[model samples]
Target: MHNDLPIRKIIHVDMDAFYASVEQLDYPDLKGKPIAVGGSGARGVISAASYEARKFGVKSAMSGRLAEKLCPNLIFVKHRFERYKEISNKIRKIFLDYTDLVEPLSLDEAYLDVTKNKIGLPSATLIAQKIRDRIFSEVGLTASAGISINKFVAKIASDYNKPNGQKTVNPEDVLQFLEELDIRKFYGVGKVTAEKMYQKGIFSGKDLKSKSIEYLEDNFGKSGKQYYYIVRGIHNSEVRPNRIRKSLAAERTFSENLSSEIFMLDKLNQIAEEVSNRLNKSKVSGKTITLKIKYSDFTLQTRSKTLPFFINDKSIILENAKELLYQDSLKNSVRLLGISLSNLNTDKKLSEEPIDKEKKSVSVQLKFEF
Candidate 1:
């Protein structure tokens, strides 16, 4: 199966602690100190942690309270996504200078197909080096690059030498590199899957590779074939250069549960404003609005409505959120409320079009007690 496919030179470039690094770059005082890019509130979660913070067992998606306990000196900084996006654009331009086959996974990571580059360079290693160098010189940030024969291996290789380093896996070495990798370290194999694999005595890539496709399918179902080929270094997923945003959302968990309708409305209004600001920043809108509620008992429920037209306005969002909130009485006291917009319209021109000042100025004000 591996010999049947062409050897495409793929490179995955990932920014080193992207958000936290950007914060440190902008604020010199944060340099050499442990910091996290996220909220510091009781229910807050860490979005990204600096390498210094990671030494203390801090990590992204960990609860902020736990991160604080892990690293007592950790400084929590609010996320500046717009600023990160600005730096990301600078890095992306550098990738385009080499090849148009760039697929961005997020603001700080992308997969580049340099099999046929603009500069006609033969070595993917050299191309990756130049890109990393340019990012440092031009954007004032460090990036790690992984060069391999395909996207799956390239993505994994990028993590091999992290924080201002690069690794290249030649076609012949692909299988060897994969076989030596830990099953837990493989992309897409989460804790649950890894535990299941461990129970089956599959601890590393070599163990996984030894299993028959029929056995993997019988155990893991549909994703079995995916693991079967990926372990053999046979991934053929092409770089999708035109990926679009699917949704925009904002959510907040209260330190104290709220049962009052007025209190819920006020929180909804704030969440709506955040969603509106992010939507306007990204120049996107959606027709579907989803309201998420999490009760104090940890039970969750979601309600959704699809509007006739796309909207990115706070007033519209808040009004719809209010309707969803009132649609049903409280089964239990809610500890969290969230609003999300989906079915996005990514057309730039539509977002850029002028809106009537009078209509856009309409704001929702909720009078409620804390």
Candidate 2:
């Protein structure tokens, strides 16, 4: 439903090459050099890469061998998930000082709602600048931010100004911004989808808007509505107060430990069914499901699979979980079993995938509670 209501202000903040930058900050000797974070072994993939390495065509998720081919002297480092989480928490604290409406997308990116704030700051633009400055000074790292009327535009804006920069869009300028945007630049149009769209004459936002809503839906299923709203800067979602734990999971801690391969698979299937029921009732679909197990000797293991699209079917979840559980040899007795799902799409509206704009810091953060 489109409404000509007063616009809201929103901001998105993302750390630049967050993991790689932290590694550089902590290691010191690796500064200003091409570096990738991951193992260099045949099976290793780059989790993150510094901007210097990106210049040589290195990218995250590329095979370590490919990364090395791009940048011959590229340094590869193991992941440090714990350290990254610690820094993420610190950044959250900083955002809290200004507002309480923070939504963390991941360790390196977050959305803040500054409609109301603790600092009583007059403008969101100043708030965004301060956040960036403080993050650099306090966390010893750079961050990029985007400010706009809603999450869709704000997130895209942040990406426009990478490496310690910010971009903002006035509510009134949304049409102009979106009109000039390439169709591929719209949020949910992945590479393959974009190619299809291009073939159908959707090279720009104007082309998208020219199509009938019915036409879009016929071709793209449900997400075509998203294109309609974001192209006009009409996102109305409030910054949630807290994040809903998109999925809930439990892992049993065995007292003695049972080492039967069949037993481990059974436990995982059970948990996946539980998770699937919970998701359906919550009106959610999940794209990723993970399996976890622990051995009698206290050794831990996990495997995960991400589907091409979200689903809340119990049979699907359990079946995928079972497949992941048996992929490798489960010779040892297991002490724990767990299941989790992510990449949630709960009747998603126009989210952070729209018009590019300027920078504004949020004074408040929203957290969603289930």
Candidate 3:
């Protein structure tokens, strides 16, 4: 089945420690120093760390205090989104010169399909080399590139030689390359899933391939089929350019866990307001409201409720979110609260009526307690 699919030339480009590197590039004194880009306060989290800091086990998402403890000399630089966006725009322009089939995963990474390009380039490897060289020469920044037949493999390959490197996986070598790969490295397989697979004696793609689709489905639900095919090097998902926004979400981790229901409700209201603002800014609404709860122990749970009509109002979203929150009993003190909207009414073909009908606001009373 994998042999029948059309081969593509996908390249995944990722910047090397983007934020920290930018800071080091602009400030000569910070070069080769252990620096982190984010707040230095107790409650602050590290957004990015220089490769030097990474050597000391300091990484993004770790608390500033932890980072400081890990690397005592670590310098924390405040995030400069404007400068990062400026550089990102420059990088994006470089990609646009090659192909229109560019999917930006973030400001620092993107997937480009160069199977057919404006420059009429046939070799994705050569294009990747040129792109990396251009970035260094023009932007004073280094990037890594991964070339493969699909986005998943390409993305993983980009990490093979980090900082400033490239890796290519040919079509004929896809199976062998994937077979030797660790299950933990497979996209979408998180820590919990990997641990589960490990317990089931599936540690690598080779082991995963040995399992039948039925066995995988029976254990992993809908993701089972995905694993079964992907292990055999069969990923057909395309690199969609100009991808549409599907959902909007807002979440916050508290400085301390909250046990009181009143405090939880207040936090939920704040999250709902943020979600509503984002939805309004995007000119979109959704019928599904989900409440995400992260316990003090780090266990996570999400409850969702689908409404009949799309809504962008804070009050309406909060009302539905509250209902979902209470649908399941609280298991532990929550350390994080989040609200999100999905099943977006973005399709013009099936959303004309709902858009008009939901234009007006509908208020719902908020009275609840644990």
Candidate 4:
């Protein structure tokens, strides 16, 4: 089954604790110490945590108070978006030096297709190492990489050797590598999905492979087919270069939860303005306005309305956001309010052509050199 498709040399590169690492890189005193990038206030959530903090079970998205409880000496730092974007652009430049097929997942991670690279390097492993080396030398940061035949496998392999390391899964080793993988480690399987899989006795890729596709689809819906293909090492998703922006959003977490809709009006206006600014900056507009509300108890709610025409103006955005806010009464005291615009003009159908679509047929190399 694998021999019919064109073999790709894909690499997934992820930075090591990006936000916290950036903070440490700028502040010398923070090196080799537990640090988190985010607010230390009551409503604050940790954006990222350094390796030193991870030893104490501190991690991103954990509450500031809980993180402090876990790591008593955890140092909190504010986020510098412009600084991070500057460093991210530098890293992206390094990626472009090797291949034009770079797909940035975020500020700290990207997928690169170096199957036919500018550098004329046949070995993807060597290319990954070179990229990692350049990142460290040029940007003063460390990254880990995973090299494999496709994006899905490469992404999972990248995490195998993290924090300044790299791993490769050759074509021949792909099936067995996936079979031995814990179901929990499969890229798309979250805790909830893993729990559902466990209920079905799918503890490992091998177990998942035992179930018929019909059985899988019956139990897991659309994702079941995806799992069936993935476990068999058959993901053909391309490394899309120009991934479109699906939405534009901005939100604020307040120091104290606001109890009344009138009190939230000012915050909502500010959030709408931010969203409008971002939409204009990106040169895109959307018809859908979504109001995101996070209550003090951590529950989240979203109200959305799709308009007939796209808009990027602050007044229009604020007006629509206000309508959505009043559409539903307060369920609880709001700790966070957000405004988002979606159904953007930039949205388009991504090409589904195979990586080697121009070629009629291709065979995987026995040894998988790249």
> Each candidate: what lDDT?
0.87, 0.78, 0.85, 0.89
lDDT of 2: 0.78
- Residues 310-347 of candidate 1 have per-residue lDDT tens digits of 99999999999999999989889888999999989863
lDDT by residue for model 4 (144-214), tens: 99999889899999999888999999887888898899999999999989999999899999999888778
On lDDT, the candidate that comes out on top is 4
Clashes, model 4: 0
Candidate 3: residue 169 Cα off by (Å): 0.4
Q: TM-score of each candidate? A: 0.76, 0.72, 0.89, 0.89
Scanning candidate 2 in windows of ten residues, the lowest lDDT window is 361-370
Q: Which regions of candidate 3 fall more than 4 Å away from where they truly are?
A: 255-257, 296-299, 328-333, 347-370
Q: Write the per-residue lDDT of candidate 2 for residues 1-370, one digit (tens) a residue.
A: 2343435668899999999999999999999999999847765668899999999999986768778887999999889999999999999999999888898888999999876778877577788999999998999999999887778888888989798999987655667787888987887789888998998999998888787767888888898766666676556667775666666565655445667767666666677778878887777788888888776554668788889988788788878877887788885887678888887884344344343222122212322110
- Candidate 2 or 3, higher TM-score? 3
Question: Which one is best on TM-score?
Answer: 4
Which residue pairs show backbone clashes in model 1? none
What's every prediction's RMSD, in angstroms? 13.3, 10.0, 11.5, 3.3
Q: Rank by lDDT, descending?
A: 4, 1, 3, 2
